[model samples]
Target chain A: MTSASPLSRLPPGPLLVLGYGNPGRLDDGLGPAFCEALRLRLGGDAHRAGPHRMTIRDAFQLNVEDAAEVADHDCVVFVDATLPGPGTFSFEPVTPSTRRAEFTTHSATPAGIMGLARDLLGADTQGYALGIRGGEFGGFGERLSPVARCHLALALDHFTALLPRQEGRPTVCATPIRGEGVHHD
Target chain B: MNPVLQTDTERIVIEPVTRVEGHGKVTIHRDAEGRVAQARLHIVEFRGFERFIQGRPYWEMPVAVQRLCGICPVSHHLCAAKAVDLLVGGESLTPTAEKIRRLMHYGQFFQSHALHFFHLASPDLLFGFDADPVDRNVLGVAAAHPELARQGILMRKWGQEIIQATAGKKVHGTGAIPGGVNRSLTREERDTLRAPVSHMLTWAREALELARGYTLENLPDVGHFGDFESNYLALVRADGAMDIYDGELRAIDPRGEILLQEPDSQRYLDVIAEEVRPWSYMKFPYLKPLGPEEGWYRVGPLARVNACDFIDTPEAEEARQEFKGLAGGGPVHHTMAYHWARMIELLHCAEVIQRLLDDDDLLGAELRTEGPRRRREGVGILEAPRGTLFHHYRVGDDDLVTRCNLIVSTTSNNEGMNRSVTQVAKQRMEGVDRITEGMMNEVEVAIRAYDPCLSCATHALGQMPLIVELVDEGGDVLDRRARSGGS
Candidate 1:
């Protein structure tokens, strides 16, 4: 509810943009798509350490081992695609779950991941989840649906807007990098 | 192992087994006298790769098969590519092509093994298997040993980086072609990988030490946990050195004596036969020569360690020596040893990757070569992270695939996994009226030793359902729980 920049209030440590989902599947790729867009807009310096430093990674899905990586970071953002939501995107703060985490298969829940980060590594890493509504997620293709693309644009705008902003230098989020204006149904 | 009980009793079903890579369950039957009746690890997911890939072109086999599972896509990609290579380039590959493929495979081993040990199995090893299920995961391991957990993640990340450097992407890259790779490694890519060589090796050594310590602590109880004697199968080089990327099929008896060592993977049909069960979608693969019941053999890390005479890599060989010493010159029948063998193989992967990085051919100009399709049918067999994987294909003259038969590593270990569960169940659950969650986890711990990738084995996509239940005599469910799991 606070208008403060999420990046500015974070503990002094590296920021991580963890994108996880099946890129091979259509709309499920929104996570990586968002990360790729962020990388392009932020330039190569995004990987380097600085006041605005951030690490970007993409995986098919979250695994148990990701907890340690998440714990190492001072701040973490989990990007994923959800089945078409009432809203185009939903950004929620993550808190460790008290319910015992289940190690089932390859995937771990975002809350489970955060819980592991906090409980296991004794990390105070603040976490947030950006769930972008996905239109299509079941096919074997990397392209996003039109509606999903629109949601991705909005999610990117909201994500970049939360980052520590600098004066004079223009932000890519201010303008459409894909040359396509965000669409509304 | 106890015989199946004929008396009426209760049944405890741990369905949709958790933590492993697929959909499965552990069922423990109790007899009238409150004794353990029978236990089985059932893989319920159906595999459709053989049917769906019928119309696809032979060239697309590598990429098409990689989509079967998100984990270990490189194994499928590289194995399928080799089979495709046989169709295009006879028995041998060009020097550069062979080295690059091997390099990629070593990377696959490094990543997959690191994942299994650090993320999957270490929770059980570091924290006791009976430890709170909530705290028995990578996160839990991290909480307990932060340094080791970080090392495991970094090691796996390095492995993925190697994959991305060689292939185009980390998950499912299209760098591999029929006769060779899509391109040679760039100087920058090579340097990036080279910088972490020593650090990776150091981390691997530390991991090996940790595994060795665990193995030593559990050695006394190892014989009681999934300790069933059976045949072992793996791919070994001509000299019987452990070879994961490419080699001849080798089968050894419980006594560690060679039973059958064949070079041609195409002749696999003559020796191996698949049996179907009404209860599970997974096929029970057995040695045809021995016939179904007596033919079942174990594969994966344990089998490979048992079947091979020695590991070629120095560090791995040393570790192998320490591992085999536990058995006093016989195959290690202890299911728990799978973790030890896996860690040893992990060392070998890092060593092999480091060795491959030193090869100049990896940076060669000639990335691919083509030849006429001399054969209509080709079989690619490699030691996948879990076990020996077989990819057989029959192509039409037009180059489209007519038939596809895949025997994944998990499928090969199907019978053994069931036996292991039964063994553990019989040992732990005997004379118990009720089954607790911790008791059920013991059965799962046995199956976890195999590290079965049920999705890959059954070719079932999406989330695998997991259910644990307690059924009273006459098969009425008393208690049940389910989890939708995907990884």
Candidate 2:
């Protein structure tokens, strides 16, 4: 199977991990830290040795560029810290639309930074959204919520699955809860 | 529920209301040494346009945002288009789109700058504050200097015509799209613009000479008064072109020191903070680097002049020469010379608009990208007639906007203008417990010089009375006056 036109031209790369969260808040740093952890696990040697430069892209304050970057890469993994709602990590593979307004940095959100990434990347970009529970927000600290720490391992397992694999031409994994019809698994 | 309430004073209590385009009053006890009393500016109507616009479709964002102000809607439209272009990457439109956009803005510049100068500020310049307040308006100016008044109206009207032709609508237009404009200009429309351009230039000279007739050495006392100073900021191209519509943000000190030049708009969140006053609907915007209490900076004409070293055109350069003379020397920091800076801008706006009308691409019909606008969440920032305006939004999957944030000039200049008011109130007020209506009106006039869009400044207003009162030391009320008429 194949995607036509613009979607067919998604960036050809080995591994792309996208971290989306507000750096100014406390636990939101979970997204960036997850990317850092993955970096430490894979090491720069792996990215440099590979064909593309998909090390880490942190959208501290997400803007339109978040979508553009994702569209330009292959095998993209999205990471973010979720707000403390159900006291659990919602690990879901999501597909999102390229519409700029669907994703946001604030409230009542369905589509997220990861969804934006998938929308831009098309089939060339394999995307996932991993969020840890957030307890204290608005303050300056990079620690996860108590409930999120428990599910950190689950997030890592999902994250690692995509990094080890090659750019599978047609990769579909999990149902996207927050994603628009732009991307589907 | 009242944002502005009275506090203790020596004898009377005063409640002041601040606004988007202008300032107000709250007076109390005087200095320990005894000069003027405590006065607070209550920004009565703050239209949290930034907050109100959340969740709107991206395409319509600019149109709605442009309505936020009557003075600089043109700039708002252009800025919105510029912002959307960043995401759309219609770089295919490049220099042509860029130049045409600039030309459209020139039309805005011509119209708005003229209105502020001739219709609003010119009355003050031609007639003294001491000149019977009843007859001291545009009508009075027409009755007095008929030719100048007529010419002023014509010049401003021509500006409106330019905008109408370019955007398909006059006051608030979304003609500028991501790829380019939604419409094109034909030769006939362009041809009609020629006479107005010549007519405005001739009238601009007459207006300048009229202003020059009242030199600083012998001018009305108020026009010659003022010494307060604050930092200035604006946008400038890397090559030094005037960046009023699409340039990097820059800030400079009164001494011409480059405090900040070509700063990133994205980083504006880091360096700038919006201050709120519950009394008035307007929000005060301050430089974040200076801290909440300390970062008070001025925007608009006086600030614009103080921000840039020179005007963009040769005619404006000559007008700048006259501006220096009006100040009796260096940068005129007085609230009064906001009039002078305004006139200079009017002259420049006309000249620039003329230059754009001479451009070839403005006639091109190809405007939009035929491509469905995919980007939904975007920010549109521009220098409006008052100051900086921001339109931010989030879209839903269906391309319908979900949320929005609109930060207009009224909000951006709120803090500093409020601070500036305290100075003027002190300068004009004599007794803390017996403030007069004229004194309050004087303060209000000081604000109208900016000609802020009250609708944009105050999201809501149902005949809010303009009240002036005198208060005592214990913040007790003494004498109070409220009127509906602005002038």
- Which candidate wins on DockQ? 1
> Residue B399 error for model 2, in Å?
4.0
Candidate 1 C-alpha lDDT tens digits along B1-487: 2134243777776766777876776667777676776777776666787898998899998888998888889999988998888888645777777887888888888988898888788888877878876677676666678788778877887888788877778888888888888877877788889898998999988888888888788778876888888999999999999999888999999999888988888898988999987767788999888889988999999999999999998999988988888889889888888988888998898888988898888889887887765788889999999999999999998889999999999988988988888878888788766667677778888888898898898765566456677667776777776655531
Index of the highest-TM-score prediction: 1
The CAPRI classification for model 1 reads as acceptable
Question: Per-residue alpha-carbon lDDT of model 2 for B47-69, expressed as tens digits?
Answer: 66666565565666567667655
Give candidate 1's TM-score.
0.88
TM-score of chain A of each: 0.84, 0.60
Please list the residue runs of candidate 1 whose C-alpha ends up more than 4 Å from where it truly belongs after superposition: A1-17, A23-26, A35-57, A64-76, A92-105, A109-128, A135-147, A160-185, B1-7, B461-466, B474-487
* Model 1 C-alpha lDDT versus the unseen true structure: 0.80
lDDT of 2: 0.57
> TM-score per candidate, in order?
0.88, 0.65
The candidates' DockQ values read 0.38, 0.01
**How does chain A of candidate 1 score by TM-score against the true chain A?**
0.84
Cα RMSD, model 1: 4.3
lDDT of 2 by residue, A1-185 (tens): 11122132224565566676644355676676566555555553465454455556554434322444555566565667876676455545456543323422111122433443343233346655566666667564445554444545456544454443346522323332121211112
